[model samples]
Target: MTRPAATAFPTPDDLFENAPCGYLVLSEDGTIRMVNGTFCRWLSCARAELVGKRIAARLSVSSRIAYETHFMPLLRLGGASHEISFDFLDAGGGAFPASVSALFCPAGEQESSIRLTVFPAVQRRRYERGLLEAREASEVARHSELETGKLREQFVAVLGHDLRNPLAAVSAGIRALSREATTERGARVLVLMEGSVQRMFGLIENILDFARARLGGGIVLTQCITDQLPAILSQVVDELRATNPDRVIDASFDLRTPVECDPSRIAQLVSNLLGNAISHGAADRPVRLSAVSTASGDLTVIVTNEGPTIPPDAMDRLFEPFVRGASSGYSEGLGLGLHIASEIAKAHDAVLDVTSEDSVTSFRLRLSAVRAS
Candidate 1:
């Protein structure tokens, strides 16, 4: 059987003696009927001295004006004044910020007097000022960041558009010479010219992709994570291996744990980590990868390699955009890897972690827990 609720304790007299805040009861005729210790301390007056005294006579002029003209009208009508702020006159006649509210108390068939609650507003004022300052600072920082990002984007756009013409002219000249000149040097020059043009185009595309990701729309999440991960990883590994034939990669995966996530973005994360390991790992050593189900039911994927130590300074900033990884051979495209990984992880509510030492450097992506069913 359920138990009945306990009886309510304490009378009004006891409440005045132990009120959490200042309380003062004034007679309708303006005499102080009763005052709690809290009110006595707030106004810097002793109970013996303040009892039976007139609140209007002792209160600060501004506080008295507000109380009598505005708050008293509301309180007499059986309504309350909500946190009307003013000041009180201390025993030494000093002013202090205060917030007060009052309500009419019932006496038999009629209202007896007003019960006033007072609170010191010093801490509250300070807190409000601090909050205002924090908001202003945040807005300024955001404005500065927006301005800087726009300027950088403009610079990239102008640079790419301006350089395209010069690259075109160079390619046209090399082509014309290869067709007319009968020398072997002409053929090799044409090949080198074509290679240089390709490299320029690749760099320009990377810059564009970076800007797009930064100012782009949200991740387009796919319903499939299980089937997409393995296929994407295999393709990325094959592409990287073909480009760097000297490096050997050993990749292992098991993504049976299904989850809702963006496949291309997830693929971006996988490719970035794997490519990072391939580039940093010793040429003869194997770049290792593993994907398994963690005890917490999330998918735990790790990419590791035996390589030179990552400096403490660089490790802290490794995932930041434009930061060069463990290997300095990276150009513009490579810097966006870890940065994109971070974006993808955040979109999936997953965690991207990195650890590095003398012989072992690893990056892991911790996915959300999948349902057993």
Candidate 2:
């Protein structure tokens, strides 16, 4: 039992014939000088047939153009080229993808050869193309979604605008009949009609405001210096009480300072809060509305009611558009009241906040002296 003697370094012929990847050595003018066995096997050709031929003849049409225009120029300038992808033609005229890397080798003072290695890249190229197609499709779908959203907002704006004229005529007819009614039953029926008209008008206003906020950036405010804010808020409460005769609302105001704000927007805000209270508050308990001006020159309005506590999850998105609380459902008008109120408060340079616990729910609006931008 003895060990064999160590072998010498592998000869050039042995190394070139058994190399893993297809290898070629070509003249600077693109004539093939030598090729490895792997290269001949890949193209199903004999060494004698390819040795004296132009290497570019083995490439497919587009690959031949790429090789002549880009790869050859880059190799001449840089002495090397890496990851040049091209399609190669086999003996049967079928095309396969290949990635080539080459280095310039100087054989003499006046002559050079290109030594190249080729790797099969058919599957990898297919995967890269698939990724590009997927990215393009995703971008197209995203653009279509944005366009659809804009169209929907525009349609809502137009619909709200067209509804106002007929609503105005309905109100005019109601007013005319109110003056002519003599019997008590006729007067009651007219009152109900007026209440319905007012409710419809409020719903339309909310829809228009929502459209403006989504399409035109946000709600706009017209600020004016006024001393009649208390009366305006009182009018909102009076209307809600008239419409909902079964509910009792206790409203109190303690303000002595002049306030600057968007009067109409503020009225809308209070009205929304009162409406929310009437819809959700305990029927037997009275809803409370309080407005006070602190000595620090801050105006605050609070609306409170006693009812089932809002779930923690529902409270988080209570002011988001189209997101309703557990108590709000299909009957509510698109769940935009609290959302619009919040936007109005923001336009007035104020904040709308809420708190609920122990069967009591309260929403508060705090307005400081700073004007909205």
Candidate 3:
């Protein structure tokens, strides 16, 4: 066998000079007593020029302050310090981040000294800066989205208001033509046209109300004490009965005490609830509406219908704008009726709640009937 070559090992001086990281030895007074070749190259200076200089001279202003106030005290007390961050100034006056660790050797027969090692941290600082910029960009995007949504809602409100005049003109012309003599087929066509116009009017009303509530003008009510609430509610029932002739609506009133409320708004709320019942309730079952007033100045109105039970997951979002029941076979409206009704109840400081079970669904409203002082 050939003789094996001798294994060469690096001596202490060779290892110190060619190390991957910067190394330095400092006296207790912070003067640089010794430095490795790696450290001298990092500062772009010769060993002779740095050996007698203070280590503070190579640090940036803030780092110099931190070194004296924080780093030196910890190393003296604990005899070792790890991962202290600082910025060092190069010969070109540029700064770079560095992570420093140091070990203190106490004095015995010679002066005390500290041995330090430094690693560059340029990549870590760059990553942290990138994270901060991305967070700021996300916040700006969210704010812009909110502003755009508000502008769109305001546009809908304006459009709804502008459409009312032409709709009213068309309705007036239809009524004038209905009064004139015509064949049986012509009369039936006129009736169909009238129904279409009524449906369009209902849609426009819902859109306008939704826009107003979203724009912060909640339901505007004119409240007063009146005994005519029963009559107002009766008129709403009659109107819906005419429109949905195939559906049976049972209404009963026991409103003995006068109630304080906006009559028109109350009428509208009842109309929405009744129409919902007619659309979703079982065809052969009667939709029920009942109103009662207590002597202690409290009022209650309930509407009940027999239908498929509402899904549990959907109950929470039923009153949210533009949300409709998934089980409904009728898809005629914009799904704003219940939301508007809830808003009206809130304006009156009333409680409106719904429950569906055993093939029955009911919406109940309760409010104080006392006159406002």
Report the number of the highest-TM-score candidate: 2
CA deviation > 4 Å runs, candidate 1:
1-23, 28-84, 89-95, 101-103, 109-111, 117-119, 168-197, 216-278, 285-320, 328-334, 337-373
Best by lDDT: 2
2 or 3, greater by lDDT: 2
lDDT of 1 by residue, 200-261 (tens): 65455445546655656544456463545667677767766655667888888776655456
Task: Write down the worst ten-residue block by lDDT for model 1.
Answer: 1-10
RMSD of each: 11.6, 5.7, 6.3
Global Cα lDDT for candidate 3? 0.86
Candidate 3: tens digits of C-alpha lDDT, residues 253-301 = 9988888888888888888888788888898899999999887758899
- Global lDDT of each candidate: 0.73, 0.86, 0.86
Rate residue 262 of model 1 by lDDT: 65
lDDT score, candidate 3, position 161:
89
Tens-digit lDDT string for candidate 2 (293-359): 7665578999999998888888888999887555644265678889999999988879999999999
**Alpha carbon lDDT at 142, candidate 3:** 89
Clashes of 1: 0
**Whole-model lDDT for model 2 versus the true structure?**
0.86
What are the TM-scores, per candidate, against the unseen true structure?
A: 0.50, 0.77, 0.73
Residue 223 lDDT, candidate 1, scale 0-100: 47
Which regions of candidate 2 deviate over 4 angstroms?
1-55, 60-84, 92-94, 100-117, 182-185, 294-297, 309-316, 326-330, 356-360, 371-373
